[model samples]
Target: MQGTLKDAREVAVKKLSRGLSQGAKVFMNKAMLLSCVQHKNVVNLHGYCTASICQKGGQRMLWTP
Candidate 1:
């Protein structure tokens, strides 16, 4: 998904797949690695969120935007 931040910066949001056995681990690893990266050629890891929403069949989402 694409969105505009409060500061008017455009960002692309990526939501990791839910319900996979290794989803949490993969999310953490990817977030960590991206956080450490600092290259102009690479898209920045602005932020991430992990949430469990009971309404959506207890959907667990990991979003990086």
Candidate 2:
């Protein structure tokens, strides 16, 4: 999904798969790692949402610009 942030920057939102057996700690670790990485070719991890409840169900999402 694509949307604009509060700061008006366009970003693509990726909803992490819920089928994985991994726990929240694993996902958070990965997010932290991605957020620290810096490279022109890599899509930076702008932010993430964990254990958020939506109308559909609980979901985890990653935001990238």
TM-score winner = 2
For model 2, the superposed segments whose C-alpha errors exceed 4 Å read: 51-56
Each candidate structure's TM-score, on Cα atoms with residue i matched to residue i, is: 0.63, 0.77
- Clashing residue pairs in all predictions, respectively, total 0, 0
Tens-digit per-residue lDDT, 21-48, candidate 1: 5376777787788889888888778876
Ten-residue region with minimum lDDT total, candidate 1: 54-63
lDDT of 2 by residue, 1-65 (tens): 99788899999988766666535777788889999999999999998878455312556778998
Model 2 lowest lDDT segment of ten: 51-60
* Residue pair clashes in candidate 1: none
lDDT of each: 0.64, 0.79
State in Å the error of residue 17, model 2: 1.7
